[model samples]
Target: MHPALSIIVFTTLSGLGYGLATALGTGLLDPAATATKAAHLLALALIAAGLMSSTLHLGNPQRAWRAFSQWRSSWLSREGVMAVLTFLPLAASAFLAIFESRYEPALGLAGAALSLVTVYCTAMIYASLKSVQTWHTPLTPLCYLLFALAGGFSLSTFFAAMGGGNLLLSSGLAAFFVCLAWIAKLVWRNRMNTLRPISTPETATGLGFIGKVRLFERPHINDNYLTNEMGFRVARKHAVKLAALSFGLGGIVPVALLLGLLALGAAHPAVAVGVALLAVLSHITGMLVERWLFFAEARHAVMNYYGG
Candidate 1:
């Protein structure tokens, strides 16, 4: 499918936002600390920005509100509903953290669980689409959830380092999550590399019993909406290069920095904070590239009719 900039930004930013919010909900940071207050504001900003960006891909942003009506059957609608519901407890918890300087176990835990459910719903938006073989798998949601945790904990490590909290522990969690996310991503990519098209030209036309089906004439003289939106293609070489870059930036560097933070034992607060910041930046950039590839590399079964 065509890689839409709005969706990419939406997923990447929201994933990070939800992840960070999850960390806060779990009471991972000291509620009374100034850094915790800042983190709360940051999480809200990221989520709001991402949710807003998501509307850009819609043909009519004004009608986007209609998406909420299909929650019974639509993953997209479920995501919208969950996103709004998740924001409530999260915002309330943030309010308490910022003003009252306290963490309520019930609110925090509720927000954390809801935050994860929202992310799962978002991933299911793509994973549920049977037309796209690349995205139709259990691994899709697994990668999405793992990446959210990895990025969330990495950002948490930065705040923990800034506040002089348990920097070592936060960094250790960050490193562990980063490792887990990358491993899952590697497995996902391998599946993409090996899986054959479930729907080919022959199967699509139901002519496999007779002979191979080939496009003798163009479907249209000019490109149509389906061709433009669902027929995007990417070269294998560029994909390999981008995949390497994503793994390195989004996974390896963050893990290394976080592991180093663990080894330092909170001896150098300033250095730890700086390193944590770099890891967050690198991880975000890497995930952006990964999200791009996630869309670019996907092959929609509808393309078989278009001679894709």
Candidate 2:
């Protein structure tokens, strides 16, 4: 499982965008406030950017539209469909906030629900893969959803601080979600560390009775698509270091910043904004490392035949 930059960007940006949309949908921010408007615009931009980046992974970007037709059977297709459908309510909510300067509770709620559903669909695209044991767990979607909320809260805190809203409440919310996100991630990593693969070379070949199966020769003299994509290997030591870094930057740092802001209480607007911005930046950077690890750490069952 090679970590593709396109998919990493898609997941990170879209998750944050949808997270912010979810907050807005739930009336976490005042619709008429300038901060709300900025948040909405940022959400839309992130979503658009993420959706577009996904096409880069396709063999034919122009034909990506065909993916929408398989929603009945494919999680990827479902994600595509939901992502598009989510835009309707999201756009309406944004329009109402910008023009009417009023929050339509119903539309906002619907948008929030749809935004979460879209992120869930995205997570399912990976979680539903039976071949990837690490991702084939309920925790996959849990981690995705929690991280999105955490990132969203962090961003909202920044917006609130800059827009002269109640920093205490927003920062508190951010801290809560950050804690949940880290907890979920820690559980996910634990599962990955201990879970046994249902597939092994011996089991895959139906020759376990013979015992101690091993690959004596390369499948080919040179690398092929399968080897290049599914046979990627990461050193255990490097993984440990990256995981620690991810936890620190993505989870610990953001939580500390939020809690610090809360403790400081009515600090200068510039100082508050700077702290919130740093939290947002650090969280995003941490998420990038985590996403890379998500792909890099996975051992596709197909690799079993290749002695992975």
How far is each candidate from the true structure, as Cα RMSD in Å?
1.1, 1.2
In Å, residue 208's CA in model 1 sits off its true spot by: 2.1
lDDT of 1 at 74: 95
TM-score of each: 0.98, 0.97
Position 59, candidate 1: lDDT: 79
Clash counts for the predictions, in order: 0, 0
Q: Residue 77 lDDT in model 1?
A: 99
lDDT by residue (tens digit), candidate 2, 147-195? 9999988998898887737678888988899899889989999999999
Clash list (residue pairs), candidate 2: none
Q: Name the lDDT value of residue 105 in candidate 2.
A: 92
Per residue, candidate 1 scores C-alpha lDDT tens digits across 1-308 of 88899999999999999999998998989999999999999999999999999998887889888998999999999999999999999999999999999999999999999999999999999999999888999999999999998999999999999992767778888899889999989999999999998899999989889998987777779988998898777634499999999999999899998988888877888998999999999999999999999998899998878888
The Cα local distance difference test for each model comes to: 0.92, 0.90
Q: What 10-residue stretch in candidate 1 is worst by lDDT?
A: 228-237
**C-alpha lDDT (0 to 100) for residue 125 of candidate 2:** 95
